[model samples]
Target chain A: MKKRDHKECVSALLPVKDTLDLIGGKWKLLIIISIWEGNKHFREIERSIPKLSTKVLAKELKELEMNKLLHRNVIDDFPVRIEYTLTEHAKSLKTVIGTLHSWGLTHRKAIFEK
Target chain B: MKKRDHKECVSALLPVKDTLDLIGGKWKLLIIISIWEGNKHFREIERSIPKLSTKVLAKELKELEMNKLLHRNVIDDFPVRIEYTLTEHAKSLKTVIGTLHSWGLTHRKAIFEK
Candidate 1:
């Protein structure tokens, strides 16, 4: 293999890594899916993912918002409520992530079966 | 809204949560894509993801291997060499992830643009 060829290969992979960095995380995708499934508020998300700590969920939601995958709307109520929904760009990811879920169901073999 | 309806909604989301747990990680998808792009050996993988630390890449590879997303082949020579490839199940995820990459290109809005 040529030395220059190796550098090209690595360079090609940088975008893949960046994409992973955006969507891959312990709670980010769960938050996205939860929002997709109709959880609009922080409490609703917390309710849906029972095992996720509040701090973790908050952090994940912030990251997703930072990544532009979610829209956070703060409703000015007595307690100050926040609602999260998918942005148009994030809405676009629905098909892809949904396909991933389908792949898990139909194609995920027993190797990682819990 | 009824309490039972809320419970049903949460239950419907459990599978999505589980699926997220599988592929959502800083390195997993990148590593999978790297393997798809044709690096098979440990050193080759290391070379492909230049920004990834050796330890982190090794750990991610092992996790993928454990999840049956990657097949690790050991070549017993003077210095035993290991090669990794996607399993059939993992291969099935290609279309989904590729679609995701395309989605990022065509549909990802400017909210998260660099």
Candidate 2:
């Protein structure tokens, strides 16, 4: 490839690398999807993902918050309920997440049926 | 959520879980994109992705092959050239990868600008 093309390739891929570093894990996207699908409370998120441990979920939640994908809201009612919601930044991931979901279905079918 | 909705949610997420298990790492997608961008040789691929160790690249290549995303070819030449190419199955990841690239750019700007 030409030097200019090579530079463009690297530039395009750097953000991809950054994105993967931020969300590359077994549980992070799953947790994000759960919250996106309305599992706002901790227990609800846990129940939605059948095999994820509470410890892992908690850790991933903190990471997502740090990355600004989601945030914590504490409702200081009589019982002090805390809920998680996707930030607008996180909501922007809907298209990416949706594409993953679609490709994932196709990938699964290709693997299992072949 | 209703019981039916919960079931649909779990079913929708299982393949995503599978997808993540197949490609969730710092290096796999990067390596895939490198090859997709025409860095077919091992060394070329290595050069394209900065800071990626040879051992990790080799491992990720094998894993991607195992998942049917890519394959290895050995050309019959004096020195025996080897090249990696995306399977049609892997090429299907183009949109997914592109979405990731776009979202990653947006994500990087969001975090840095705020």
Candidate 3:
């Protein structure tokens, strides 16, 4: 309605926007999470998260690799193993995940009480 | 390849899932950030975030209200005024938002360096 400037907040908002754009969906973050928790193989990640289908997991994994969030490894073993691991850049999500974990636990209790 | 248990991490994952489900999009968190910065009126919020269409903003506002993350107030005047504000429950997201902000900043730098 009136002419006002939001430029002051833009510097603060852009990075958060990037963060959301990168990890905004349910599967992307959960996939990184499964790998973070030690599930490397495709099947292990799918099994760890209930309701995540193979198609979605495969897609998210590829996207994460493209984004350089994870490394898709090919081990030439007797059976040939493929594993996924978080890159250094992605390991930086440790704090972000820890913060979400704490808030999520508290939020669950708060929601039920409402 | 191997049979292993991911059961131990379920406690950690569910709340994170809840967190992701609640605030996984670019608009929702940005909307809250705009409100947190004192943009109350619909127009004020609309102008604050770039590339956010009226359709998306309106839809996000309703969803946020449904989730009890914010309150919508209507004031009767010559021109009816509607304002949006975060609730106490949503205020608890302060830590989550802060964490993301820091991580996002770091992430942007890491991305460019690669």
Could you say which candidate leads in DockQ? 2
**How many residue-pair clashes does candidate 2 contain?**
0
Clashing pairs in 1: none
Please give each candidate's TM-score.
Answer: 0.80, 0.88, 0.89
What fraction of the true interface does each of the listed models get right, in terms of native contacts kept? 0.52, 0.71, 0.65
Candidate 2, residues A1-113: lDDT per residue as tens digits? 22222454555578787778777878888888888888889999999897999998889999889888889999999899999999888888888788888888778667655
Q: What DockQ values do the models have?
A: 0.44, 0.64, 0.57
lDDT of 2 at B43: 95
Mind giving the per-residue lDDT tens digits that candidate 1 earns over A1-114?
Answer: 232233434433554445556676666767777888888988889977768899988888888887788888988988888889898767777776777666655543354444
Per-residue lDDT value at B79 in model 3 = 88
Report residue B31 deviation for candidate 2 (angstroms).
Answer: 0.8
Model 2 C-alpha lDDT per residue in residues B11-109, reported as the tens digit of each score: 557767777877787888888888877889999999888899999888899989988889899999889999999998778888888888888876776
For residue B101, give model 3's deviation from the true position in Å.
Answer: 0.6
- B10-105, model 1: which lDDT tens digit per residue? 433555555556676677777787788888887777766657789998788877777778888898997988888888777777677776676644
Off by over 4 Å in 2: A1-11, B1-11
Q: Write candidate 3's Cα lDDT for A1-113 as tens digits.
A: 31135445554577788788778787888888888888999999999899999998888888888788999999998899999999987888888888888888777556655
Q: Per-candidate interface C-alpha RMSD?
A: 2.8, 1.5, 1.5
